[model samples]
Target: MMDRPVGVIGAGRVGTALGLALVRAGYELVGVNARSEASRQRAADVLPGTPLRDVPTLAKSAGILLLSVTDDAIGSVAAELADGGLLQPGQIVLHVSGACGLAVLAPATEAGAVPLAVHPAMTFPGLPTDADNLAGLAYAVTTRPHDRPLAEELVRDVGGVPVWIADEDRTLYHAALVLGANNLITLLAAAMEALMAAGVPDPGFVLAPLVRASMENALRHGDQALTGPVRRADVGTIEAHLRALRDRAPHLLPAYLDFGLNTARRSRRAALNEAGRLDEVIALLEARSAEARDDIDR
Candidate 1:
């Protein structure tokens, strides 16, 4: 079963990279079904000389079908394959959507295909280096009870560890990843822009060590790694910073207050002695919120 030819239904970043990696792992590459010219070109580059065929053709020629389409398109594509009578018994069908589960492949299953979800828990730039990026990363796998072992094996073959996730937990699991990966990118961009606004010549150079060390510490000690005014409950220092933000960078004030409030709450839960200080900080935040409301009303 592991030696069977695998066909990719989409040719975007995940599809191309995974196809290339599977080829490298000794799995037979069964060509691809790309929807667009760009996708066809990508497949040609990654799995060069692999034949380009239609969805049903690709499904017929391969023992495994990987649906690497967009989230919304996944269900439709499954339905299309099922309608075309392409999914054969004992064949495997998987998608790389973190938020989706085996349910999206109901169409495929009804056609006798074994449904599975195999999401790589990492960002894909769709470049040639994507295969290297896959090494040592985790894969979120959602599948039927009996299919778990095969799913884990497939992930291992792709150079990733499989983390079994319940179908119902897929939403929460994907949300956590987005908050950590996507939102972290947004936060970093904001920090870099704010530093540049403050006359820093190179924000990346200035932030590199500080950001890296903080990340390392947080990974090691969790909330205990927290520092600065929020951790110490220094009301005056926080107030001063809030004032500076309002004057010099008003756009950043809302985010600052929101993070400060969340930090204060976390600190109270982590340390009993800090409750009083945290209460004071919360009061200050509430006051500021009231002032903002009043200003908006005016």
Candidate 2:
């Protein structure tokens, strides 16, 4: 597989980053198929000297074809390549969708091509250092048992550690990533807004150390790291927070209530809080949520 050139079907952020990594790893990027101007420009900028070709041309020329398109578009793209008689026997076809499995590449499989799902469990922000982010990160790989060696080798070639994820578990695995990475951003943005509303000049600077410590603690100790008013059963502090959010950031009230209730439940489960006190916190959050809904209805 290393001897064969690799072709990228979609030159988006993830695609371009992966292509660049492979090139740096000494694999020849034979061609790229980028539809949008932005994607084309990204390919030209990152993968200099690589020809921008059409899908069929890429499929025909390269021995390994990477369909780094969106999760929803993988099947159609694979079908297109298969129907065009472009995917050849023994050719390798792979996708970078964390949510999708080998099913999306069934068309390519039917065309006698090897199908692999290699999802890098890292963000690619399309920066010059995006390729460096691939080093030591996990790649959720799903492929046939017979193709495991090739899949692992390919992941290692791009500086990723291959973690075998069953096809049936791909969606669930991806969901966990979204809940951790994507939702962390949403929660941080909300926190920063609330801090700014409270007259903090530099919300990020104020929260950075605290947030970093909290995350590190959570990662290291899991539920044992639960703290704050919810865990301590500081009902007065909880009520004050609800009142402050309701008065100053009305839109944040619902989320605040939800997170508070979840934190209380986690505390209760971890035995970090007295059962009765945690129940009081839960009740208070539920009541605030009900009141918010009533306001919305009115």
| Candidate number with greatest lDDT | 2
Tens digits of per-residue lDDT for model 2, 1-298: 5888999999877777888898888888889999988888888787888998988788878988988788899999999999999988989998989999999999999999999999888888777678879888899999999999999988899889999999999999999999889988989999999999999989999999999999999999998998899999999998899889989999988888888888899999989978998999889888889989999999
Clashing pairs in 2: none
TM-scores for every candidate against the unseen true structure: 0.94, 0.98
Give me the candidate number with maximum TM-score. Answer: 2
- The parts of candidate 2 lying over 4 Å away from their true place are none
Q: How close is candidate 2 to the true structure, as a TM-score?
A: 0.98
Task: State how far residue 239 of model 1 sits from its true place (Å).
Answer: 1.6
Each prediction's RMSD to truth: 1.8, 1.0
